[model samples]
Target: MTLMHKILGTAAAFALSAGAALSEPAMIYDLGGKFDKSFNEAAFAGAEKWKAETGETYREIELQSEAQREQALRRFAEAGLNPIVMAGFAFGSILEEVAADYPDTKFAIIDMVVDAPNVRSIVFSEHEGSYLAGMMAAMASKTGTVGFIGGMDIPLIRKFACGYVQGVKAANPDATVIQNMTGTTPTAWNDPVKGGELTRAQISQGADVIYAAAGGTGVGVLQTAADEGILSIGVDSNQNYMHPGQVLTSMVKRVDVAVYDAFMSGADLETGIFTLGLAQDGVGYAVDDNNAALVNDDMIAAVEDAKAKIISGEIVVHDYMTDNTCPVK
Candidate 1:
């Protein structure tokens, strides 16, 4: 979609906004939205950045129901915003159609690849971050088994699970990795009830640490951990405060970076792909309030080393949807 450009000398540019700025930094979120604290919340953080950077007011349209996804995209595009951004891979189809329909409005979708001239699709190599988390899970587990709870059984979530399992195997050959999904649909991302139940099930099956990439559902998983006296890892955002000392670590996606950079890149260049990975400082593990004491500095150092390898093209993290695992690399 072609983004609407303001008058060359008009309005507050991102680089120069002596006025009150755009006054409307808008974001369109996929199903889980704000409270999810995983996908949508990260985008909200970006909105916060936009507010901080331009002094422009930002608006967010959250999709509470799956059916509303397309509608939300259309409404945001019709709102005549500069760049209408969408979060989550599940919104790929909706974003494509919406961008096509609103050619004058530039569109950016996170976690998905859309090959449109006017759309800047930003994707993160989540596997690399997940691998480090997987390694940590293995090292911290006393049961020799770690659990993975995903929001949905989609290919994107699967990519996270696959990378995690492989990392655990590479770190501790003897450890077993358990995987479970919150549900089959998008609402699964917000259903904490299912998330808590799944975490308990994994624990019952001898899981020592649970890694959750289940959006809002992850909150429930952490709640289970705190109540059950087990360990849990968070995704997307730094959720260490959710469970304090019990919530081990979090794989930070830096969605805030992606959103702000995309806006700047879109303003600077017309079209291209922006792949934010470890090298770009787009993804990493968080060392915050809860995890400072539990995580070893050496482990963080090891992740940095792995990050360097990936950045230099030495360690290749494969995505299940794009790469085949048949030959077992």
Candidate 2:
């Protein structure tokens, strides 16, 4: 049984009746919908995996607006949902406000930290994975220029860009990187048109490989890169299959693992700040049958060596969140 609900208006949109079973886990997806083929979709995959393995049903809701954040959290908690998982960093403040109200209802939020005892904050070292993707992009680029387009213009996305530029410089110091952000608002996460425009603009500037850290917007980046006969890198999910040979690689963030672990823990979920990085397989680049021919043996060797060095602390990828500044432009 899968109780998937799409909340378009107020909290009243959630149809979970009071008679529903208590202690069941729930998931709340951020904007861009669950099928945006990016971040939220990866989280949905985790919930589906849990359902497939345990034959248990979990409640899920796709948020339609920023105003629905607190409403949805309260609705689920009031209905006795335990260990509710939210898929984006935007939920941090709301979770902080609501976690205290529901002492027995454990809550888990990804990509942000809430200092509450019953709230589990899971963050990832996205910079590390983006670095590896950068290496692949630099090595695969024929024009000596790559581009990065991000969504929401936040420190988190900057972290991705910064790491990528570092890796590109490490691979080819002469390589040029062009970076852009979709927007400052939440709508940026779902704007594929803007993503496409940015990709084309970068292409005009001599970029042959591009990386998209935007959410649904990345779909446009990948599609435009494919249509233009250039290489693109994906974020937060294995998006190589989306464009096959046209996608150089993807910075695969283990958002599914975070959701799966939260659901598997049930009501007894531990509450604390958990960080996932290259050392813990929390982030990586994807190489599958779809794009295996694109990444050759030398590219693999160089990326793997960097991965090991990053994990061993020998290579410190600057974290933009630390000082809100990237070492390289």
Candidate 3:
């Protein structure tokens, strides 16, 4: 659905009168569009699921430009929307600013932390999941070399790459992990052309398995991997269906569940940092029928073993944001 434009004082009355009976959740989708088929799509899936189960409709806006971030948040907040949901970390500063002006409104933001009392920040153990994807990529690689394509050169995406490299090393210490970022700006998230070029470059370096944590850009990475007949891994959502046999597996992060839960919580939605990890079943590797043939029983067993260790604290996946360095990479 189209988003309402941000305007000052127009929604002030609506905000004052907001309550349980008038509560209506609103969502602000991040750039790259909601159908990026990766991160934003996962959040959409969760929002859709909530609507189907509860028969309640919510307002939403898809961001088309960088300026729209704050505009969407303010527009929804001023309109008396009870719980405003934002899809990405880019909204952190904006959400923090808007939330204070509307203290009665509850806001839920995924992938970022907002210190406002009314905001619920949800983050996932993407590194843990990416590590598993790394292990699978390494094991599935015939060339003993794998690659990683990131959407943007941000600390968050680096966290994905570092964990993947760690996983690759754990499985095959001799394996080489090549890495590249689509771009240094937000445009990187949706640049399929750049994604394809990066994939080809990695392949030229002997990388047979590539993991794409590049949002919409990953579509290009996956398509190229399939065209070149190389194994590839997907991120954020279960993308095995995209390439079927050619896709080794997808590092599934449950953005859908986070969104679904927030919407379901309604007016009383809890506000704070909510972290989803392997232990909480918030992040994992996809192993459905789509890629069942590509992942054998041994691979499944090995990954599961590692998963258990990670959850039990026996294995700690280093977070790249922790120190801005990847030991394995």
Candidate 4:
């Protein structure tokens, strides 16, 4: 074998490897979207992990308008990418139509379910995780009242509120839950100004501790908590860093882990609605480098006890439409 022939073969192999890596699909992030450091960041972490370990390339389309949702998904499909990942509950219906049309391509959506042979729906037992957060807030609250703020009026967001209400009540039956929505539209998650306003309103209503599940809007809630000198709970991702010292603890939803796992296991994007909750490290409390000092050992121990009880089947968190037969409106 001549030296020239050996070099040519090596170059060809390298090109083929590069081509394969570039063929992977992209991800579409919902509005109030990427770098939220709460929700979208979790999905972004998954894409990053894919790039680092699997050598796959993924792009993200930040949704600004409703039309962007359809356009972004279609653009990725037309570009010949496979398994486009979509984040957020807002894309539920969009995933249904796109996945059906692009039978050759695969689609993965988080937080909602759509039935398509080519799609995988990744959901979370958010209620279960929120329930745990509720317990933490109740135990940690000095004011005996905590507030719940949701990003939207959708049933999905309600799940978070319901779990929180139950968890707090279980911990301190006298605990009052003041719930508010950022908005009724998809823009609800993105409006931090409104989120803060609502947070302030809840504070006025006697809520000493507030939990913001309103995506980017939650940032406002965190800011309010910090500015007002009160306690706040974060949602979707570890938000303890949002306000550093003021954020009591975050309801850690392992969205990053979910995104990474899906990327690693591609063939089964269909027939899978991977729900991450307390048991799978999919959701829990966040306390490491950021706000560990803010939470006492007893709080951690109690949360751990609740976790074990949950895992051991002693506690079953309620889904508003399901287990919560007589849900409080």
Choose the strongest candidate by lDDT: 2
Per-residue lDDT of model 4, residues 223-247, tens digit only: 9879998889988777787677788
TM-score of each: 0.85, 0.90, 0.92, 0.84
**Order of all candidates by TM-score, from best down to worst?**
3, 2, 1, 4
Candidate 4: list runs displaced more than 4 Å. Answer: 1-22, 54-56, 266-271, 321-329
Candidate 2 wrongly placed segments (more than 4 Å): 1-22
Q: Model-by-model lDDT, in order? A: 0.77, 0.90, 0.89, 0.79
On TM-score, the candidate that comes out on top is 3
Which 10-residue window in model 1 sums to the lowest lDDT? 1-10
Candidate 3 per-residue lDDT over residues 44-153, each given as its tens digit = 99999999998878888998888988888887776777688889898988777788998988999999888888889999999999999999998999999999999988
lDDT of candidate 2 over 1-329, digit per residue (tens): 12333232113323443323235689999877899777899999999999999998888899988999999999988766777999998898888889999887899999999999899999999999999999999999999999999998888889999999999999999999999999998889889999999999999999999999999999999999999999999999888899878898899999999999999998879999999999899999999999999999999999999999999999999999989888887
> With candidate 1 superimposed using the best TM-score fit, by how many Å does residue 275's alpha carbon deviate from the native?
1.2
User: In candidate 1, residue 319 scores what lDDT?
Assistant: 68
Give all candidate RMSDs, comma-separated.
5.0, 4.8, 3.2, 5.7
Deviation (Å) of 78 in candidate 1: 4.4
* Whole-structure CA lDDT of model 1: 0.77
Output the better candidate (3/4) by TM-score.
Answer: 3
Tell me the lDDT of model 4 at 261.
Answer: 69
Q: What's the residue-level lDDT of 174 in candidate 2?
A: 97
Clashing pairs in 2: none
